[model samples]
Target: MRVSSLLRFRSTSLQTSIAKQQQYVPQHKPAVQDDIKRLEDFLISKPNILVLSGAGISTESGIPDYRSEGVGLYARTNHKPIQHLEFVKSSSVRKRYWARNFVGWPNFSSTQPNATHHALARFEREMRVQAVVTQNVDRLHTKAGSRNIVELHGSGYVVKCLSCEYRIDRHEFQTILATLNPAFKDAPDMIRPDGDVEIPVDYIENFHIPECPECGGNLKPEIVFFGDCVPRPRLDKIAEMVYNSDGLLVLGSSLLVFSGYRMVLQMKDLKLPVAIVNIGDTRADHLADIKISAKCGDVIPKLFDFRKTNPL
Candidate 1:
């Protein structure tokens, strides 16, 4: 079956299974303001904090995250992301990947930073936040004017030549793609969490992929794919930042991916205080000194006392 058809079938099967299963609704309890206070106190105590963020931070800006309770990509569908090996090994895989990216890039690039991003930027300015290491490839932190940032997963806005190491702006490449694949200029409007959209298998078959203008080599987005490893230099920089900071603050991440979760383990080894602010349960809840189960947009703005009265 085609990739899109397979995904749709899986989604149908999942929904049918869920509908047939007996659901148990959990009891709702009123939220405690003390949790917020504790988070505030934790931030106040740590003069230099290293913030590790994830996709959850960008959800407020209308970008879908990967692992939220009812809204994440996994929760909604069974479509898996492209692995590094597949992408590098097969031309057909490259065509399909770029085709989806071609359809999704417009909306993905146009997304603006939300309140959570602004709040983090403000914290950086106040010297409370030393640096931010984010698992997201959206570049929202940079857009929000946060200077010290480490993009654990590289940005989607950059395209690099696999052979010559030449890089070009993603937007520029998008124009090239449109010119080459005029037939695919009007692809479906379904955008995925990772800036990829769903395209029919027929569209994938006819999609024209462009080669690097410099070396006529394969071009790929400079992101860490599922089967790819994070660069050692980036890991070393993050470790240095964590070591220099007084404590670690996790914002909107479940810590499911070991790349971000390993930081929590390192902090535990160092005996540094760790504070987590996320909507759902995280893998490192037990290691956190303070866990605030709330939306980052709702709680992050309240953590700091700004002069602007209308700050939200």
Candidate 2:
């Protein structure tokens, strides 16, 4: 199906689901004190907890998520991101991808970490958190002072040569792009969460793409695109962290992707307690020992504050 058709279908399906829920479901309720206490107790019991975060965590910092109801990228547009195979095989695809990225880079790069990120960093500093494994490519965790982190998807701040070991900083590459395509330097500011923007095909066709200066190779972002595999070494490292940690605490993720969902499944296999903090239903909701439907920014700071006042 065409991208537009797919998006329209999804939008219609989502609208129908929302209408049905409005008719059948009761009004939303605020988080209860008992739920907060349960989460706090879980944290106190497991100091060496591994945190699994996803796009929802970064939404508070002004980056849009891919799957949030009525506000996600899927619900808002029909732009399908470049697939890994298409990028490797087609120069036309590469040209269009880089063009959109050029326009979106500034705003995407300027986003700062929010309260949830800072609270997680504090947890790491206090030795209460074992490590953080995130599915986001924005590097907000690193920016927030999180020392121990495993980025499930690689960072978007670096670009690598396909045929050589050469790497270039994305910001520096942006300067090169501006130099190559001066006409596009002043392009309208439209940014996406994945560092891509909407650009007309005619404009994209005129955009100049750069090759690896060091080896004349194709350049691509360091992110793990769809249809690409996460490096086995990274997976092994995350598995080790899960094995060593006392329990798992998921923050702001729906766990729709199998990669992030697998961690929750691993915790279940080990019979370790799992607690989730998200605004909606997650894939592992049934498996979680404690599930609190709330925003991570609101819940995490309160959790840390609760810990300070009532130390276990």
> Each candidate's TM vs. the true structure?
0.85, 0.86
Instruction: Report the C-alpha lDDT of model 1 over 1-312, residue by residue, as the tens digit.
Output: 999999999999978644322121111233466876788788888889899998878876767776666656666676567899999999999998898788888878988887789988999998878889999999999999999999998999899988997999999999999898878746655554343367778889998887888889999999999989999999998888888888999988989999999999988888999999887789999999988877776678767666554667
Clashes of 1: 0
Residues 44-143 of candidate 2: C-alpha lDDT, one tens digit per residue? 8899999999888887776777777765667667767569999999989999899988898887898888888998998999888999999998999999
TM-score for candidate 2, residues paired by index = 0.86
lDDT of each: 0.82, 0.84
Q: Report the error of model 1 at residue 273, Å.
A: 0.7
Task: Give Cα distance to truth, residue 140, candidate 2, Å.
Answer: 0.9
Candidate 2 ranges beyond 4 A from true positions: 1-29, 189-196, 306-312
Q: How many residue pairs clash in each candidate?
A: 0, 0
The alpha-carbon deviation from the true structure for residue 106 of candidate 2, after best TM-score superposition, in angstroms, is 0.5
lDDT of 1: 0.82
Stretches of candidate 1 above 4 Å error?
Answer: 1-31, 188-196, 307-312
